[model samples]
Target: MLAATEKALEAEMNRLKLAVKTLQGEDKSEEIYIGSYLLARLEELGVTSMFGVPGDFNLGFLDLVEDHPTIDWVGNCNELNASYAADGYARVKQGSVGVLLTTFGVGELSAMNGMAGAFSEMVPMVHIAGVPSLRQQATKPMLHHTLGDGRFDAYIKAAEQFTYSQAILTNTVSAGAEIDRVLSDCVIKGRPVYITLPTDLAYAKISSDRLKIPLPRHPSPNNADVESFVIDEIVKQIAEADGDVVVIADACAIRHDAIDELKDLLYKTGYPVYCAPMGKSAIDETYERYGGIYVGSISRPEIKEKVESAKLILSIGSLKSDFNSGNFTYSIPTTRTIELHSHWTNIKYAEFPNIGMKQLLPKLTARLEGGKAKALQLEVPRFDAHVPQETDDIISQAWFWPRMSKFFEPKDVVIAETGTSSFGILDVPLPKDSVFLSQILWGSIGWTVGSTLGAALAAKDCNLNRTILFVGDGSLQLTVQELSTMLRKGLKPIIFVLNNSGYTIERFLHGKERKYNDIVNWKWTGLLEVLGDLDGTLSKSYTVNNKSELTELLENPKFAAAEVLQLVEVMMPKHDAPRALQVQAELSGKTNQYAL
Candidate 1:
């Protein structure tokens, strides 16, 4: 207890010391360049690489990035892919915001789709754009990248709808402070922001004194009386229940950096913990008390029944999007749920405002440890389910997913596209410390390819085992060029191409046999040879049309433990879909959510 208190005191003292230094404007130094300052801040936040493409407007800033000591510039094929890569990096790195750079109007506009997804999913990032000089803005000159209408503020206006904060560095005097403000908000809100840096201002000198200031990393919640009463009432609520208590971990656990706190709470209370699809990797999946994932109609039978029939449900960081909640299919009423969020929490429809989960959860968890509970002893259901045989030449969905479960190792990062791959992974149990990456709420198909680039880099920095990606053939065709960039950086993520030959997810959504769902065939197994390096060295690629072939490859020691890039094209029937996907489609179709 003394050691823990001393650690807390030390952290508080360091925070105070930094705050005091910022207040005094300690010994202004002329040693900082604007671009250098940006890169330095990122490096301090544990960011090893910045993702973007080099354009003429942003080339000056790239020069500073190139000369930086620790930060590397990861140039992508285009702006949109760069944005996707940054989003993935932020997701895997945990507590660090993604950084993306682009040129003025054309580049920023093209990358808007990626930022929109970030906004919808609450991913943190800083999107910087290199615009024309301040002189050109004053003269209203028609720039090459602009619409020739001389409206300089047009793009930033569009960006405002998609970002939490937006700023244009028109003066060097305020550039440092403005940058700090925007970055502070990005980290605090866990949302993307937009900053337009002028071409000429990229080289301006700035004071580095502000670097001494530290952002408030932890929340200092208010309403002490409300907090005390709430926790007591929460305990009472649980004790009042007759049957069992459960915790539903959601995506914001990852967004708000509450994984440890949530885990501590569950462990202390000894309650069964189930994860939403968006929160798949947030909790310790290997935990003995872990129930499978729950998402309304699509959830596994055991999970759905356990969660819905529980005496009380405690949902932490809940976000129920169309895809996440199985199109509003959750059976638990608000009266039965105790929903805790970062800022506010509610119990049985009673609101407690001005309380932060980052600060409140630990108290609640500790309070439950020694306190008596009605349902102190509970048992989670054990499933001895069998994996069915394929009984055919092609690898079926059931056979492929469960087979890959044993292949996963600890500390690995797995990314699945927003199609059959994501739905198929719901049943497989991941290895300990493995991170799951997906954009389900946004439902972007090809986001995984670019995100894999960023995720692989992050995994390498943390010395994780592997960065694996599961993408369908149709989705891969959208942004497959990122594979070349991955090769350029020498990142070796295990790529699994679910080669069903068309938009299988879309077919389930609206078009079962529509011509719009079909795509042109590509030689998936020969991609490495086409995108070889200057030395003509190629990564390994394999095509598997039979179960035995895939079994042999997965069982091979050298293939399972890979050092370079490897791609496996797994063939299955075009109409094959995961059970979850089929259930979700039936629900949506019955409600006319998708076209007839």
Candidate 2:
């Protein structure tokens, strides 16, 4: 009896010990200031780094950042560059949130362009800004950095346009909950969120016991029944169609993690599947049966004929916008057209037969299982196969891309800048499941370099290798400061910069008459070396002025080992005018009376 009692006592003591350890592990008992608490919540959300310029209002938060080991504050030349860097980091991090901090008024305002890009691309990020104290709200005293009447109203308005949610931490009591709410929404929605941390609240103590970190709600498809029925009807129409069937995927398709199932449906139906420009990396780019970019430079006469003859078009996760559809030339008949969308919100050009993709994709995949649908077998006629090779010119962007394409495997990521490099890479074939990221909708420059760093870090965690960035000389100079962060994190990315001396795309649009299109050129390789901490051991520059030199450099194994190899002075004649540039110019001229 004594033995049994002793054993029970021992077991109870062991349980108590474990409970104590678990409580000790939490360490949530510390009474930290509100700003500190907010920073702690950011850490919990897996944001290991922050990029921004510190100002008077945010200096206290910056001090807190210095003390924290988990979160590293990355300083940039300006707020605009910092925002771009944070956006780049978000794209590369893969499920981890990007954080950007800025002071009130101009500092926060400068980040709007980059934040808007994140919103358009659906990259998750948290943008935090420092504002004046809440106590001075009623008096409306002259706050430093305020625009008019001591208010930062414009910043809030700009943030509303780009973020999924916004919060203003007015006092110590509201800081913890507000930070938790904004971060939670960003994770759940897969979009950017904004929060304003008042300067006066930074040092105010908050009770740790009262702070409750609530679990975020996952939004599910609400009208499942209607969505399913619509999908079934659309699939039935496609199954009955005669000529051919083609599926064009968009950004939302990639966001839903439905690419694999979409691929399976396409393969089963034997229909050719093509991706919009923004949706290039949504599926395995190297899939043997994959079709090329359908709406951009790769769009050929044969492909257009197939699209026109197709009795039914399945646009899964597409917006059917002007750019995605090649200026609405490939309009679908109401009886034969089907659209799948993530949100049921009203979409533009909704005249065609449409339904939410969230409901459509799953039902279509299921119904098409065991049902027979004829395969699309259209011959793609090569336009340039017969052209004689030119020997004297500098390396064409088109020629360089194919060579670089060979280096990319199924797991590699390609981030292209918004210029000649982006247009050049659109035609380069990718391996299956390889990702391609760019600022498509917002059309921002200097995005690719920073985004590549973030992507490399994310890829490293997944055991994926090789995050490549291709940027123009003009774009690289805009946000080159982020190279320090990449070096600090020990991220090795092969940055292939096309050393064009100007904004080639803008010059192409403006007919080379605009002197503003040209940029003061830099020796890119030397600049990168100067910025980062390399002991001169990194792979360096190979200036290729002609096609022969480029070919030789690509073949050399030594080129790969170099940490940052800037292919300097590669002259590409604004020869092949990108189709998108032409369209954009026409659209701009048509929409704006003054441009005419």
Candidate 3:
């Protein structure tokens, strides 16, 4: 009996010894740190670069990112720009997530607006914040970055409103699971997520076992009954249609990673493919069945007549924001419409739940493999930028856009700002493999400055063509500091600053002549030198006031082929606006008049 009791006592002592060893951090040699694990998961998801501004709290986490071989840390000028950069990164690379690293309270709060915009537009981004240690939180010490009220949850509570999932890793034991869960939420939902990792927890040891398993990013849900019913209803609508069946693809088609399936569906059915303004460049525009862009009231006459008169409209991944739908001018009837979304499908008035685009698209494409092609009545207008133009005229809004058409090449990632830049580019057809990113739904000015940095990085990763940015002066002023970051990174993009003087979109909205729509003028071309430390090696900026100068710059072979950062400020009339913008603004004004 004594021998057995002694054996049990020895076992208890050994267990206690191990417990003490773990407490003293002696047994962590075989374990992986949470920082390394988080990066590994991100690398597994193909994150080649992370964008953020470094701060005292997040320096430790940044160290791990720096040490990682697969991912590079892109330092931004500020947290807001970093968040916008992440949004742009996600938009360029389909099915890949963007990560933004920042510090606690001040850092996270400053990035809220940019992340909120991502949430509104369904871009998946991870906003990882380095916060005060759990020990500091428990002691309730007043922190420099905190609000000093001792309640540490205020920033997180604010984030909860914008983020799809918010996780605080106070306990290292649950860090791996928590990180996986939050990132999964971001990817699966296509929205930004907030993850607060305490400064102490960055180096915390977690089991390496979880790293062996892949985190589920895309969760496919299949309700056989619902899908069957949904597919049957969709096929029947097309069959009973009197006119040609047309498709209206939108931004979510790219967000939901359904481009390939969409291509297959269009190919098999021989349906004419048209993109909503948000979904511009979602498909290969060079394809034979490619139709023009459809923005309802703002659509070109031929395109509008074809779409409105369609017998059945297959709207895929459609997010019908007012701007996307041409100020709510869509006239397609519910009885003749079928909508396919990432989460659900609506056939006319009936919506079937639990049917996701990623899963249903493939099945639907297979069903339509031998389906009949629609006989389109009208042909989309052919686009050509080489049209005749006067030699010595001042560049106007009418002349600038078509002139830009010849400037674009295949594989270019075009980013347009919220004002004149965004609306003007709507009329220009993108080249093959090109992308169009704009904050039409969110309408945040100055977003393109930071997004240009991200889109350039992503474009380099994919070996795509140039990164082009179009922003008005007022919008550029809001986030122009990011130019320094772009110069520092040695990325080359053609940045066109519409020198229309001020907030052209806002002027179009309400204040055409109000002081609120005007802004202080700066030497726009001199900015590149100022931001680039006056070094010609970093970038070249120019200001063009007339048509000849702009055309001359476009025709310069050296400028066209140069790998240096190029900035061109195109001067135009202050009162000029795109036709679409003018019409939409007028309609919106009348709509608001009823409220007044």
RMSD of each: 2.7, 8.4, 8.7
* Candidate 2 per-residue lDDT over residues 317-361, each given as its tens digit: 664444455545554565556666555422223432324344345
Q: Report the Cα lDDT for residue 463, model 1.
A: 80
lDDT of each: 0.83, 0.66, 0.83
TM-score of 2: 0.82
lDDT of each residue in 1-596, candidate 1, tens digit only: 22222333454554576556546553555558787877777777787888888788899998888888887889898888999999999999887878999998889998898999999888989899988889998998877988889888899999999999987899876777677767767876789999888888888887787676555444444467988898899888877874378889999888977787888888777888888889888876788778778899788787888899898999999889977888789999887899888778889879888676766788888877663244446666642234576567678887788888878899889999998999889778787899999898998889999999999988887788899999999999989989999998998889999989799988998889999999998998778777764454547888988888988998999887877899999988899998888888888777776343
Order of the predicted models by TM-score, top scorer first: 1, 3, 2
TM-score of each: 0.94, 0.82, 0.93
lDDT of 3: 0.83
Off by over 4 Å in 2: 1-33, 36-45, 63-69, 172-177, 203-214, 242-244, 267-270, 296-298, 319-325, 331-335, 345-360, 372-388, 532-535, 561-569, 574-596
lDDT of 2 at 153: 64
Q: State residue 19's C-alpha deviation in candidate 1, in Å.
A: 9.2
Model 3 steric clash pairs = none
Best by TM-score: 1
* Tens digit of per-residue lDDT, candidate 3, span 473-555: 99999999999888888888899999888888888788789999999999988888888757588788888889889999999
